[model samples]
Target: MLPGPRRLKRPSDFGATVRRGSRAATPTVVVHVRRTIDQDPPDFTRVGFVVSKKVGNAVTRNRVKRRLRHFAGDLDAQFNTDVVVRALPAAALEPQRVRDDLEDAWARAFARAAAC
Candidate 1:
């Protein structure tokens, strides 16, 4: 699990990140990356996850979410900006695929962010 301070818990934050941030999508996940604002800790990068009913029932959704959280926690040290990862239905079927897609999405999203 990610530490509380490193998690994006507000609805408004999720909305803004998805609306204005750079995005990248792969087969199983989509990633949004946004530069942190002045009020946020200069060295801390927050992460949030979106696993909707469309991805699975409650059990499956939670499983996917847990998997994503673990992966995000591991990758947290590498991120310099806020990130939101949205899981697709495909993510419920294969953990390996989800991990691969998340990495790809992160790379692409950050690359786009860097270009701006």
Candidate 2:
């Protein structure tokens, strides 16, 4: 069979780097992050996405995943930490709405991480 897409092989490469090394959340999504303190100089970090069927049908789920991936890629430089974003059912409301919520969630997560 043919090989899968290159992007699928490197999931971690698509995530952002928040200021802190832990996870946080908001109303729209749940961020789960684990820092690698063991490594002398950490290697590439890892990230994953989790969206439930409640979000919508297969197509809708794929669309949401794509949006999250895009957002993660775009925000990679803004943060300096690893994150796994779990999309909430509310995220299926609208593209822009979901984006807005995700942004808000990220901000909250960053702030919480900073506090710790």
Off by over 4 Å in 2: 1-23, 40-45, 76-80
> What is residue 92's positional error in candidate 1, in angstroms?
0.3
**For candidate 1, what is the lDDT?**
0.87
Off by over 4 Å in 1: 39-42, 76-79
Per-prediction count of colliding residue pairs?
A: 0, 6
Cα RMSD for predicted model 1 = 1.6
- What lDDT would each prediction earn against the true structure? 0.87, 0.60
lDDT of 2 by residue, 1-116 (tens): 11122122344433433333456666567765544344462344345577889889999888888888777655432334456678877777756676666677666666766566
* Model 2: how far residue 93 lies from native, Å: 2.2
In terms of lDDT, model 2 sits at 0.60
